[model samples]
Target: MSATVSREGNASVAGVNGPVLGDADFRFLREFVLQHCGIALSEQKRQLVQGRLLRRLRALNMKDFGSYCDLLRRDPDGEMGDLASAISTNVTSFFRESHHYDLLEKTLIPQWLAHKRRQGDRLRIWSAGCSTGEEPYALAMVLAEALEKHGAPFDAKILATDLSPQALQGAREGVYSLDKMDGISAERRRRWFLRGEGSYEGLACIHPRLRELVTIQPLNLLHDWPMAGLFDAIFCRNVVIYFDKPTKERLFSRYAKQLEPEGYLFLGHSESMHGLSDDFDLVGRTVYRKRAS
Candidate 1:
């Protein structure tokens, strides 16, 4: 459950180069990835996959692609997260898409908080495929402000999930480099982040208040989810670009089921639900609302 795949060569391997990925191994890998991660790898992407997975092969002290395939065959679930990480890109930033947050801050949250205050209901936002925690933390800032403004004792939380263990660990740590703070405004920088000093200089740790609102967890979007409760909104931006039509359809349908009626489903700028699913209606740029059934 992540964004576009990286085409860069794998340089993190222990060795200078990796063994060539054979045709049989490549085929097995394509099928395995599609089956497990819902990513359809075309024939042209073989070299890219080989290059990216080379680091894994070298790290595991493997000599051949066949052996890697064997490892996957033996323990698919155990290795799926790392495998997905190797192939997918975790490129994300705080407030990557600002307008979505604007809608939430200006309209959606106010309305929801008002209703929740009266109904004594909980507020939930699911940051599906929330890479490295930025999305959910940015979401938390907005949520915290709204809750304070409304002055309600609402049970509100943001569920931040990703398929990469590395990403989830980063999210849980809530620390970031100074350069990564570009998308964040100066005011938010002071308000929501504590600037580091001395040896930890140039890095900023997220405020404790934001951390309280977000629950970072590892999750694969294609697999079964443990969350039984429905969400008020789900932000799944940029993560569906690699999924094929059938996969997208299935994912969207599942998202609809997991959403409250009329809940929002936000997609990436490039993604579209057109001719894919009937459960959602296009409401704004890359934004969809669950159709009332």
Candidate 2:
């Protein structure tokens, strides 16, 4: 994959006119991010664009921003996602929104079970842009408890995706600092994690059992999703804060189509589908369900 991304190109910014970043430079990065990740950035965050992309400038040894932008255009295999991952914010932890998980256990899971018992359906969950695997692990904990009740096995899956390969790897490994586990309940912490042992002191690792229920993969949301069946619930969470208006519209529509009728969609509390789509109806809080058929 790295071989195809033009890593060894002859494009150099040495002695070249560099981007000084006035209105024009800011405009270039803003448009570039929108084109690449479907994220619409605020002009107020222009300082953010400068701070984030400056690393890219240094990494490529480019004399200025224009040369870096030119290099991005030439990377045939679409490594721009790597850059997007670098700039995008990632702030999530185990059960960050405990109320949502409470809803998942007390409300959503039971409803899904009732539907499954009636329709003979298998559960499907997608954690779009799952940062470091907590949502999926939390889902697994819910599913594991759900499975324990029936006294029989059921096939299920959690698809955890992110643009950052590093994040995906972290999600896959399922290890974390003890500090990140602050708000989780004692019972959940006990059940889901293996406390640090020996040389691995101070850090915790997700029990190997819970880790098996989820699959972590690299995904670029701006492109077509290579999936077939609809999902029973999608925990999109705070992932949409970076997306532009057009991207948000189309992406929600796609999620609407890919979700089972009556299936749920969870968004960041700050993210509202208000002007975006009516395909989903608000349930309690930030949770949403697809409008009945």
Candidate number with greatest TM-score: 1
lDDT of 2 at 277: 94
lDDT of model 2, residue 172: 80
Winning candidate number (lDDT):
1
Question: What C-alpha lDDT do the candidate models reach, one value each?
Answer: 0.89, 0.78
lDDT of 2 by residue, 140-172 (tens): 888888877866667678889888876788898
Error of 2 at 270 (Å): 0.8
Model 1 reaches what TM-score against the true structure?
0.93
**Clash pairs detected, candidate 1:** none
> Where's the lowest-lDDT run of ten residues in candidate 2?
1-10
Query: Residue by residue across 1-293, what tens digits does model 1's lDDT show?
Result: 11222123322222245466656677788999999999999999988998998889878988667778889999998889899999998889999889999999999999988887888889999999998899999999999999889874679999999998888999998999999999989999999999888876889999999999999888999988999899999999999998989999999999999998899999998899999999999999999999999
Off by over 4 Å in 1: 1-16
Worst 10 residues of 1 by lDDT: 1-10
